[model samples]
Target: MSVTPITTANLLARQLKNLINSGSLKDGDRLIERDLASQFSVSRIPMREAIRQLEQEGLVKVYRNRGAVVKTLDASDIDEIYQLRALLEGEAIFQSMNYMDTETMARAELVHRLLGSASEPTQQGLYNREFHELLYRRCKNHRLLEMINGLREQIERYELFQRRLLSDTLKFQDEHEQILIACQHNNPAAARENTVSHILSAGEILKSYLLSR
Candidate 1:
């Protein structure tokens, strides 16, 4: 992959996120200092910052001696995410429809192709985020977008845990298509309803994987 133009911490997050999504950094895998530092070709300082960022995102747990291990998310986190998404995403989409129009719709239509061609899971995941954010930006509500951004980050990272849960992953792709369709049709209610089902389904899927792990 071409080196992305990103901040040191963001670059670290992307690499570690890639590790998790690719199954190299398996769930609950403890981060080894020397190994990761060597692999990333960076100093320990940036590596530590990345770990701290992951911990903030609920992707890693920073223990006393263990350094950092990926968190085994419990049911409560899933529930909260879905609950929050249902509460917020609907309004965000409704507000967005007024701001997003034909040109943005054309661009959104092409984004799916980019996501489909992504070679790796993390790339696909980031594209997935960019896809939704493009639509979300139409809302023109900064605070709402900020809140939803955090929610999306948590949702995406947790969903990454379902690497072998192919069924749910496929379901998400279908849901993404549905979201795009709703946006194209300019139906906010349909878009909102679809998003709620999508997020709630995600919570259920995540719960099964979390419990099994």
Candidate 2:
């Protein structure tokens, strides 16, 4: 078994991604190579490489004079992302219904249970991803799944805020249950509808929250 080594740049990129997703590094915040290198006890080379990685991931934007700034999305961006998510994930779940079996559903149920029990926003978000991925992975459309995951990554920073709200969490859980039930009953239309509705509802809530702030 060959294990890939984790390079310094890769490690720094993952840490920076966590910081951004957790909102520790807010939108529009500048990523200074010298400052970050000193803060992380790394050399400037790896820090620069790390910022480049994030730039490719759409989390950081590089300007000629301003260096790299954390990417910020407006309400319209949020709405558009969720719209795409609904379309892609709805199709994914609809297609995956043909492949969903007892074992997969059982795993999804377990993930849902874990999500309910998760106390921290980050942990809950992870389980939420797990649950959704388990359902969508069986779609057998690799490119479709890739696009869905990419869009999910784009909105994760905003999702951190939504996860922190108990009301929002409760609503999402209920929707998750609806989706799971639809799957178990072999109702693909209902599953897709529930998934679309869930994404749109969450998008609206997040957009409102951001606008109010």
Candidate 3:
């Protein structure tokens, strides 16, 4: 039996990602590499690497001589991110249809069930991503998955806000059900359409809410 080794940078990245997603690292929060290194009890190299990875994911901005700051999304940025999500995720579901087996469908069903029962918006968001990832991951395109996950991460804060501010988590779960059912029935066209609609609808709601803020 072999276990994959977790690199220091990977560990640091995961920790930082959690902080960002949980709103511990608010938008525009400065991230000092030396301070983070000392806080995490790791060397500066891994800390810098983790910050660089987050920057690549659009979660961090590196400023000359000012270290890194958490990235802030404006209305247009949110619109573009969600639009790209709708496009890429719809395509991912379309391409994954042929590769989705009965077992994978079953797994997606289980994730959907869990998502449906999640009580909190934050937890629901986690299960929601899991369910969608299960459906789309079989696209067999690493680059596409990377892009999708990046967009997903970029929307985490807004998702949490939406979930808490609205009573529409159940509505979102219903759409997830529709997508999963389409996948189970081997209807890629329906799944693709539902996936795109689901993303765009959520984006509109979030965009309106954000603009009102």
Best by lDDT: 2
TM-score of 3: 0.84
Task: Please give the TM-score that candidate 1 achieves against the real structure.
Answer: 0.69
| lDDT agreement with native, every candidate | 0.75, 0.90, 0.86
Per-residue CA lDDT of candidate 1, range 18-96, in tens?
Answer: 7775567766789986788888898888888888888887778888977899776578977887789777877787789
Q: Which stretches of candidate 3 lie over 4 Å from their true place?
A: 1-7, 165-169
| Alpha-carbon lDDT of model 1 | 0.75
Report RMSD (Å) for each prediction in the order shown: 5.4, 2.7, 2.9
Give model 2's TM-score versus the native structure. Answer: 0.85
> How close is every model to the real structure, measured as TM-score?
0.69, 0.85, 0.84
Better of 1 and 2 by lDDT: 2
Instruction: Give lDDT tens digits, candidate 2, residues 1-213.
Output: 999999999999999999998789999999999999999998999999999998887789999998999998889988888999999999999999999999999999999988888888778877888899999888989999999988878778888687787334488889999999999999999999999999899889889988998
* Runs off by more than 4 Å, candidate 2: 1-7, 113-123, 166-169
